[model samples]
Every structure is written in C-alpha cells, then in structure tokens.
Target: MHELSIVMNIIDIATEQVQQAHARKVDSIELEIGTMAGVEMDALDFSWSAAVRNTVLSDAERVVDRVPAIARCGNCGLEFRVSEPFMPCPACDNVLVEYLQGKELRVKSLVVS
Candidate 1:
C-alpha cells in the first residue's frame, strides 16, 4: 500500500528534524490526517511499525488527529460537514462545493529529546 511510502517519508522527515535539533530521538509525533486524505488507519499503523524499525521514530509515541471533512456550498454559501467529497450541500442541494478541510496529511508536531 502507499501508506508504506507515506510512513517512510514521515520517518525520513523525523530523522532530519532530530538531526537538525541534535536530539537523541523523537519522544512523540503528532499528525494531522484528514478523513478525505485516503489513508487507511490500519494500513498506516501497519506501515509505521515496519518503516520505523531502528529509526529515530522507532519508540516515538504516534498521535493522529482525524479531521472531519467540511465543505462550503457554492450556491447557498453554506458551510457544513461532509463525509465524502461528492456530498451535496445539506442546505441547498448543491453538488458543486469547495472543500474547507479534510484533505490534509501532514506532520503537525514532533517532541524530540
């Protein structure tokens, strides 16, 4: 799965950050992963376990903040939560909308020590 690559990339970033800070290892990591980011949590967890072996993040506490998808109606200017990308606006039945959030996939914070 692509989650493996994603986890590997995160490890690489953590490694670089630890080196830059001259820290021994990462104590914890906080991630912001939106629902619409298309990452399966189980797959990500599995990938993380394998990718972080002998790395700076090997023993780091991992925290993921799941962001719910939100969209703004183009026709009615109404903002609402959405479970999927193509969801019609609840107020105006508008299919066309702009995503306000829930596409994020990033490392939010790292606690190094």
Candidate 2:
C-alpha cells in the first residue's frame, strides 16, 4: 500500500530531524491529517510502526491529529465542514466555495528527549 511508502518517508524525515537536533530518543511524532488527505489512519499507524521497527525511533509513538475539511461558499459566505470532497454548499447550493483547510498532511510537532 502507498501508506507504507508514506510512513517510510515520514520516518526518514523524522530521523533526520532527530539527528539534527541531537536528540537521544524520540518520544512521539505528531501528524496533522486532513479529512481530504485520503490517508487511512489505521493503515498509516500500522505502517509507521513497521517502518520504524529497526530504526532509532523504534520506540517512538505516532499521533495523528485529524482535521476536518472546511470550505466557504462564494455565494453565501457560509463556512461548513464536509466529510467528502466536492460537497455543495448547504446554504446557497453553490459549488464555487473556496477551501480554507483540508487536504493537508504535515508534521505538527515532535516530542524528543
């Protein structure tokens, strides 16, 4: 699955960050996952565990912060959260809403010793 590759990339970056910071150990890695990022949380976590199995971050914990997909309607200026993509605006039934957040996957914080 692509989640395995993604986890590997995350570990690589986290490892580099840990080494650059001269940290003895990594306690945890926090990830911000958007609703539209199309990543399976369970799969990502499982892949992350496997990816870091033999690395310095073997004991590191993976924490995912789920972010909802939010957008603003262009016609009515109404903001709403959606679980799926291409959601129509509820107020004005407009489809020209601008997305303010979602489809974002990033490292938010790292807890290291």
Candidate 3:
C-alpha cells in the first residue's frame, strides 16, 4: 500500500528533524490529517510502526489529529463541515463550494528530548 511509503517518508523526515535538533530521542510526532486527505489512518498507524522499527524514532509515538473538511458555499454563503468529497451545499444545493480545510496531511509537531 502507499501508506507504507508515506510512513517511510514520515520516518525519514522525523529522523532528520531529530538529528537536526540534536535530541536524544523522539517522544512523539503529531500529524494533522484532514478528512478528505484520502489517507487511511489505521493503515498509516500500522505502517508507521513497521517503518520506524529500526530507526532512531523507533520509540516515537505517532499521534494523528483529525481535521474536518470545511467548505463555504458560493451561492448561499453557508459554511459547513463535510466528511467526503464532492460535497454540495446543503442550503442552496450548489455544487460550487470553496474548501477552507481538509485534503491536508502534515506533521504538525514533534516532541523531542
């Protein structure tokens, strides 16, 4: 699965950050995952454990924060949260909605010591 590659990349980045910061070890890695980011959280978690097996971040805990998909309707100016893609405006049934959040996957923070 692509999740393996994704986790591998994450581990690589975390390792680099840990080295750069000259930390003894990485305690936690926080990730912000949007609802529409198309990433499977469970798979990512499983892959993370496997990916970090032999790395310096082997003991690092992966924390995922779910970010809701928020969009504003162009026709009605209504804002709402969505769980999936192709979300039409509920109020005006408008297909044109500007997305304010979601579709994002990023490492938000790292706790090192």
Candidate 4:
C-alpha cells in the first residue's frame, strides 16, 4: 500500500524536526488527515508500527484528526458536507464544486523531548 510511503514520509519529517529541536524522541504527533485524502486509517496504522521501528518516532503517540469533507457548489454557492466524490449539490444539483476542506494531509504538530 502507498500508506507505507506516507508513514515513511511522516517518519522522515518527525525525525528531522526532532533532530532540529535537539530532541531525542518524539512524545506525540498530531496529524490532520482529511476524509477525501484517500488514506485508509487501518492500513496507515499497520504501516506506522513498521515504519517507526527503531526511529525517533518509535514510541511516539499518533493522533489523527479526521476532517470532514466539505464542498461548495459553483452554480448555487451552496456549501455542504460531502460523503462521497462527485456529489451533486443539493440546491442546484450541480456536480461541479470546489472543495473547501477535507483534502488536507499534513502533520499539524509534534511534542518532542
């Protein structure tokens, strides 16, 4: 799965941050992963354990904040939560929309010591 690569990237970032801050290990990590980011949580968790092995994040606590997908209809300017891709707008039945959020995939914060 590509989730492993994502985990590895996280590991690299965290490691760099920890090292830059003169920290030995990361205590906790906060991640913002949007529903529309296409990341499978279970698969991510499984890969995490392996990816962090013997690394600075080996004992780090991972906290993922799930962001609900939201979209705004281009035609009606109506905004609503999106449960699936290409959802038609409730107001104008427009399939074309702009995402306001839920495409996020980033590490929000880290606590290292």
Model 3 per-residue lDDT tens digits across residues 1-113: 88888888887888889899998778998998888888988888788777788786799877888899999999999999975687899888899999899877898999988
Please provide the root mean square deviation of candidate 4 (C-alpha atoms, Å).
0.8
- Between prediction 1 and prediction 2, the one with superior TM-score is 1
Provide the TM-score for each candidate, comma-separated.
0.95, 0.88, 0.90, 0.96
lDDT of each: 0.94, 0.84, 0.85, 0.94
Candidate 4 local distance difference test against the native? 0.94
Off by over 4 Å in 4: none
> Mind giving the per-residue lDDT tens digits that candidate 1 earns over 1-113?
99999999999999999999999899999999999899999999999998899999999999999999998999999999996667999987989999999989999999999
Count of steric clashes across candidates, in order: 0, 0, 0, 0
Clashes of 1: 0
Model 2 scores what on Cα lDDT?
0.84
Q: Give the Å shift of residue 11 in candidate 1.
A: 0.5
Candidate number with greatest TM-score: 4
